[model samples]
Target chain A: MPRVDVELPSVLTGLLGVPRVVPVEASCLADALRELSELHPTIDVHLFDETGGFREHVLCFHNETNTRWLDGTDVALADGDRITIMQAVSGG
Target chain B: MGTTAVIGTAKGGFILRSDDRRTWSVEGPLFKGWKLTTTSRTPAGTYLAATASDVYGTAVHRSRDLAEWEQVETGPAWPAAAEGGGNGEARKLKQIWTFGHGGNRTYAGVDDAGLFASDDDGVSWTPVDGLNEHSTRSGWFPGAGGLCAHAVLVDPADPKRLWCGISAVGVFRSDDGGASWTPKNEGIPIVIEDKSCKDIGRCVHGMVADPKDANTIYRREHVGVFRTRDGGEHWERIEHGLPSWFGFPIVMDVPTNTLFLAPLESDEYRMPVDGRLSVYRSRDGGDSWEDASAGLPAEHAYVGVLRGAMAADQDGGVYLGTTGGQVYVSSDGADSWQTLPVTLPRVLSVEVYPS
Candidate 1:
């Protein structure tokens, strides 16, 4: 099993009750998110929309690569990979 | 009673505690960098703050003490974009404009124009479908402020009666506990040129209900100030004593029949009239107005006060937060003013809690 460090923005740490960075064991991006959601269930709605897709305003970067532009969340993860979730800067 | 002024701002929320109304201690930017658009207190003493981020959607946070906050997971949400609702535009909760408490329910007016209610002491919320799914919603377009349902007034006498004000769409009243709604903009002048002047296209800036009589209401609008004696069945222009017709935020002292408004130069230039900071007050129910600028800046103050950025405490203490990040307080019912010691981000809403 591969492990990755997940970084959450300040906007989410208050709701998720987790530190800015946390390490979780997973084989892929989807598995890591699932583990993150398990750790903090209330954060799912903020990350994904009703359709279970990444919310329009959310941006997930897998070490500076936009995850949405990738082929799929099933892209294999490796040990020490970093995943950062941020909201697209737009409105106030 | 100790007074606490809870202010919502572009960056977060601040709580100012005052024992003598002259000295104060401030705590906050709670919710730290998130935009706190509005703040209110439930009858049960729960403080609710409406928070939003361009990325995470809108949420409400509740606190018993002004320090610790717990975000409500079940905040307002619109139906799926594919649901064919919201007049073909995706309904998103951009801002939570106002909160009203009546009977055992708490109501929230939200941007993208919708109403929501919480029966569980601000812990959760449910959309008021009657207003969200109204038949005439298609005609309710966005104004300069965006299509925001910014005012909620729940009649104290009848828990079932309520009124909601939205930008450009005007006001709507519900007689059956929000099960249905009817437009209530009989005499409000419409300022948007794209919409029909004869219809419900009036852009209401801010509204406050008379504490003594829920039937009487005062509103500052894009065109002018207005009042309704019969709970929105009819409204009359009441901009006689003001320096300018355009303004935002209206606060009323029901005990004295006094109303306060901060008039802007014009809709195109939404700054204080003549670049001077002045708050106008009407003592006789909007018949005439008088400048209430004592202790405020005399000139070169070109800031604008937002719609939800002014509030009146139960004891008649008034406060106004301006876009330039100044908080002005008037302990003697708007007769004079004193600026708070600190400067903050753009103030969105000002609420007073007396304990």
Candidate 2:
């Protein structure tokens, strides 16, 4: 079982009203999100597009660097790997 | 984990959320009718809320527990009508866009005029008479938004020296604590083609002063994002790694000086590259930038982040509310992000309470 650690965004933590960090089994980064989507259904709606591609403002990182700059969406994951999902927000 | 507060405004009033980086319980729709513009906590356990409504003039509300709210009407109130009370007509009362607290006084940037100051915790007010006395107000004009003061930076180390960014006016600095003001636009680029950009302040969308080093400041102008090392004396544009040079809302990690910006796609009015959402970050100030839009939607889409919709936490966490009624969160700095459940009619502002 590939161990995956989920880190909830600060904005989500406040909305859900709790700290969320769960371990799941997945072979790739996309699989991990699919598994967690079962727990937070709303997130999945904004994460994936009509063609099932990631949104433009939405960014994914395996560790600290962007996954797009690495292996695109085919990036594989190993046990104890971490993933983060964030979107762009701007205001003056 | 420390306490962080998130205040957002909508159709009815304001909502307050207190969290400890992990959990948060809703505290309010604190005030009614007024869309809360800004909230800043005072050292004496007091909180100030700047609000504006369609029916009433803009006013500052005060609170103690973040629950109960009271409108402060004694001090320099908004201009009254012929019979007294706020302008009885439509959209007449001024709007308070942003505010800052320094020493024992809290200053507010009221739309249509200059700044307002309060000494007794939002109880009373007096216009910073110097703004009228200043020789620069006449030269300062309104931008995309009507005449509005959207950003105010107060040097924590030196209360007397301060800077404010207005919509169309660019940036102004007052080193003698509002006694006088000057236009500081030396290296800032201007939109005009004939005159010198030095005399006029560049059109600024958002700005943040490093809490750790007051001398360092980052700003997002109508053209690009620029930083000043020796305060506003000089500036350098830094938009090499961003998707588009046009953007609003710039936030900094209070203790770390890390900067975050949300850029909109260029070549279009208010559209993203591909229906995507991307938030960029600069860890070492604005020296460099890295995109943190993983798990976000695609580009070439129509979604614009408005002013006052982005905020950050002391834990390196960032939050943003969009015009599409969506809120996104990033816990591990700006490395990765995810969507949140809270949706609003139209998110005017998003803030994270410090822990």
Task: Return the top candidate by TM-score.
Answer: 1
Stretches > 4 Å off in candidate 1: A14-16, A49-52, A88-92, B82-87, B192-198
State the DockQ of every prediction: 0.49, 0.01
> For model 1, how big is the CA root-mean-square deviation?
2.3
**What is each predicted model's overall lDDT from 0 to 1?**
0.84, 0.68
Query: What TM-score would every model get versus the actual structure?
Result: 0.94, 0.72
Residues B1-355, model 1: lDDT tens digits:
6899988898888889998788889998787777888888898888898887767767788989877778777888776672323257666667788889999899999888888999999998999999988877767778777899999998888989999998888899999999999989888766553333355777888889986788899987887888999989999998887889788888887677788888889988899887898889898888899999898888999988988888888677889999989999999987789999979999988988888
How would you encode candidate 1's per-residue C-alpha lDDT over A1-92 as one tens digit per residue?
98899999877897546699979999989999999988876677678764578888899999879998998899789898999999777658
Q: What are the per-residue Cα lDDT tens digits for candidate 2 across B1-355?
A: 5545455565433343445444545445555434667777765668777765443335566778666666564433333221111122211225777778788778887676467788877788887766533455545555666666788888898888888887666778889998888776667777532233345645788888887777788998887889898879888988778878787899988776678888886524765655677888887777788888875665544777877889887677888777776777777787777666565555677766654
The prediction achieving the highest lDDT against the true structure is 1
- Listed per candidate, the RMSD to the true structure in angstroms reads 2.3, 20.6
| Candidate 2 segments exceeding 4 Å error | A1-92, B2-4, B12-24, B75-93, B192-198, B266-268, B299-301
- In model 1, pairs of residues that clash are none
